[model samples]
Target: MVEVKLHDIGEGMTEADINCYLVKPGDFVKADDPLVEVQTDKMTAEIPAPRSGVIKELLLTPGQTVKVGTTLLIMEDSSGGSKTVELQKVAEAVNSEAPQADAAVVVLDRPAEVKVPVGVSARLGRILASPYTRKVARENAVNIMEVKGTGPAGRITEEDILAFVKLRDHGGASTSEAGSEQQVPNISKYASEQEVPNVSQRASESKAPNVSEVGSEVKTAAGHETVGKSQDILPFRGRRKQIAKKMVQSIYTIPHCTHFEEIDVSELIALREEIKASGNSISATAFFIKALSIGLKEFPVFNAKLDEENESIQLLREHHIGIAVDTPEGLIVPVIRNVEQKNLKQIHDEMKRLTKLALDDKLTVQDISGGTFTISNVGPLGGSIGATPIIQHPQTALVSFHKTKKRPVATDQDEIVIRSIMNLSMAFDHRVADGATAVAFTNRFAQLIENPKLMLLELM
Candidate 1:
């Protein structure tokens, strides 16, 4: 029997939620056949089978969080005839009794059924903490069984252990003995009861010495002191944690440099308004994506991602743009495939569908994969001017668009007039491109936006 353990899903992913299982027990699978889909904070990845075999068991369930190195599924080698048949029998037995079993079963090679150990309550003389809590206790050299539990199901929580440490330092007296439970005792009572020296009074009572005596006084070497400032301890647990880690890694690994340009998109804005005025439904993001697709043909380098494992750069001929959507949980980028071949109307329809799916959390693994570039817009929130955006890893660049506002700009003839101006900032990896190359690319992008006709042209 071979166990398929959870492998690293890139970007330092240590854990993920099991999204779904593609195959069930007793199903035959070939090498590289997708077995399950797992969702990390960053992306949804489909894990494929390592070898051809019959699935013996699925160790994890959907919606369960699994760490790296945890056994996800077990498969029996088909080479051994009787052994494979025996494995199938074991699998059938486990599946048939799994839902009805009162005790959790830990399946081993042996035929005899062995029950996994149940957790004992700390007050009952054994640690009643979870594996995670036990890890934390071991790191701090605290005995898990000695700590009192304040968690559901009598589990020992981190807060409970910290409170115990405070009690130990304060002479082992319960807070109730200090009068008001919420308040500490007076210095006199505290010092007398705890037998701790009162440094403030002792310093005040010291005799006044001569200047030489004071100068000759010895002092202990200073050790590092912690800055006693409160920090927002956001748990690095779900989607948000994944986004944060990926963004930080991308920023550090890729030498990102942003170049910003203001475009007089008054014509595009007028066109959109006319379309809307005629009772037509369209999104500004779709228009932006169409313009970017045209720009990418002229600047193919921007339509590429770094192939780090091969130590080479991969420039994709096909344009697959990822639209960044802000969901309640976190940011999710769903890709719109084959943008270069799609017309403006098709792009708009796909954008609408993808956005709805993203908001509803109904996006599939295929919808989130194969993005060559990304587009993030803050225009809906009414923020003018764009800022640098981090490149989604492997992708070389990301374009950030700001809200268009009426601003004065000098025309070619040097006459200033009010026009709809929008900020466009393209952040690219400097390691893959230089300033002149980025500037030339942005200039072409600016020209395409300035003249909608240029964007409509099929330039191969």
Candidate 2:
């Protein structure tokens, strides 16, 4: 039997949540067949089977986070009839600690199952609470099974526990003394007998509602009576949760600095129009990507990631640029590999194809991996002239492009003319690049865009 471990899916991914399992035990699968789907911070991807085999066992579950090198599934090679012989080979390959050790003697065992003990009342359908709530209930020595559920589907949520606590406190009864009410002795006679005021009575009288009674409605100044909506209480799950974690990590770990520049792109616009008039359609983003790739070649420092663990910076030779495509579901970056090697027409065609694939939800893991830099264009929607964009992690910089507008600029010593002007904003990791370097890089980029001939030469 061969065990399939989680392989590196790129973008510095160390772990992934198992979104779904496509196959079950005893099912035959072919080589390259999708075995499972995994969701990372960027995208959801299908993990394909390595070889034709019958699934022996599934080791992971949906919504469970798994790390790299963690075994996901066990498979029996159909071509190899002897399971023992195949497993021995797998053991030899996986266990590289002792090369001279005997592989046949080593045994691989399945992991043990963990059993969560349920209370007697809970098992009798008297309780409906989440695992976390049940743990809290056990810690407080409170029987959740006796507490009525106030959440959807008769599930006991955290709010229900708080409400229960309030009720217990106001009711003035211990769990042991629940069914009994103490007789009120004559206070005046008791005071006379003790010759002092009862301090316990004063303390009991001071207990009141902390805020308001449970199930009370809140009203706004607009006279709208608002009720607490359960829909607003959403679980942090899936892509949205993944994005939040990554954003926090990026902001806290990476030191970022932004540089902005405005450039006249009249020549580039003319070239685009000339091409389009010849029955060729291309997006402005494609033009910007082609220009940015050339600029990266001139300033290699901007195309790098900070290796904090190694206490060094990595400069990459490959020019794979990620284009951020906004989809209805979320934002996805589909990388175009080796942009320096492709012609402008080829780049334009690939961008068009990838953008369509992105919008249609047809992009694959291969299309989204291995980005050295990123470009996000806000020109199509016609928004702000310039704004700093957050850099996608593992990539050192991102370029934000704004809409082109016609503005008056000096054409020569004697006259002024209308030209197409746009803003280019570059946000970089300050740990890898400085302000002067960023300015120089963006200047070269603007030069290429302003002079179409220079951009064409760079493409060559």
Candidate 3:
């Protein structure tokens, strides 16, 4: 028998929450087949089989947070003939009984029965769905276990949850109406580019007045809806909890100082249009990233980490810039490595690829870690004026770019002219860099952004 333990997937993660199981006891699996999915503080990773074998038993349940090195399941080697009788007896015992409410059986053509994790209060067997799917169900106040799954191995999907919502709202629609359910709600806007969502209706409107989680809705004694201890609450686990912990640690440990500045991006915007006219389209953010890399070369102090234990500050040579992406779950920062080495086109392509991966929740640990600096662009989300952005811990500085608007400004000749002005907020660890240095750093960045062609001289 081989013990399938939860090893450290990456970034020295000590614990992870069990998401779901892909297979169950008595099911035959090949070498390197994914067995279970675990959600760490940063990413969701699957643990694969060590070798071809029969799944003996699952020792852990979904939603349980466990540490590294804990045994997740037991697998029996298929080549061992000595314990064949015992394995068969165990398998028979598992198959003979009616499916327990704690386990949901996936309908399959094969003889092996796979049991998935059940909902906390589900009395009708188990629920097979990804974490994101479950989140969508919870947000919409739908009982996930009651919804019939139409995915592989009977797994529930986002579309399935939306269909269930429409069905529930209509209260048993006719056969034709149910079949013609094509007007799906737009869920993409709910997860905006910034952490703050700009939806018309909040999740609270559909949620139960005094409910916390599903199956936990409680009514008031007087039959009047009033806010209670658990009214309109969200679960503080997974990514949300991880972000809170880090924010607290960073704010408490680092002496942060913020510097605000405005840049005239009229030239940059015109430059992008010219490039687009010539069949090359580029994002304004790509220009911002490239200009920042050049600024980091001049002011390396802001592109460094403080080693308090050794009483030294280490300036990083390579620029690994982290872009903050907001997802339905929470905020995630995926890094674009070696920005100083890559050209504008390369940077633009890599940024788009990483952002897509982040939005889809497919980012790996390698894609997020090893960041020398971080940048948050709130411009798309409509923060036009400014913000006091937080610096990622250990890194010396972080810059947030706000919306650009055409405004009148005075030129060097004392003449008024209309230019595209954008505000920026730069936060830094005051322990490592003073306000003077931070201002100088932003000045250098503003110079490159104001003059779009100035970056050509520094480009490699």
Candidate closest to the true structure, highest lDDT: 3
Stretch of 10 with least lDDT, candidate 2: 116-125
Question: What is the C-alpha local distance difference test score of each model?
Answer: 0.65, 0.66, 0.72
Q: Candidate 1 lDDT, tens digit per residue, 1-460?
A: 8899889866456888775565556554557756776777755567888886677788987667789889999987766466455444543454344432211211333344322112221011123443334434544545443455556534466676566567656667342321111111122211122232221122122111112222233333465333543323334445765677788989889999999988778777777788899998667677778878887887888888777788887778999999999976579899999998987788999999998877755676678878899999887779657798999987899998888888888889999999988888989988777878888887877776777666655643
Give the lDDT of residue 69 in candidate 1.
89
- The alpha-carbon lDDT assigned to residue 129 of candidate 3 equals 57
What is the C-alpha lDDT profile of model 3 across 147-243, one tens digit per residue? Answer: 5566654456789879978887879733343222111111122112113221112211221113354334456777855443344556555666667
- Please tell me which model should have the higher TM-score, number 2 or number 3: 3
Candidate rank order under lDDT: 3, 2, 1
Candidate number with the higher TM-score (1 or 2) = 2
TM-score winner among the candidates? 3
Q: Output the better candidate (1/3) by lDDT.
A: 3
Cα lDDT, model 3, residue 331: 80
TM-score of 3: 0.71
Q: List residue ranges in candidate 3 displaced over 4 A.
A: 26-28, 54-57, 77-81, 84-230
Quote model 1's TM-score: 0.57
Candidate 2 per-residue C-alpha lDDT over 159-215 given as tens digits, one digit per residue, 9 for 90 to 100: 655666776768843433321111111212111222222211211221111232434
Residue-pair clash count for candidate 2: 0
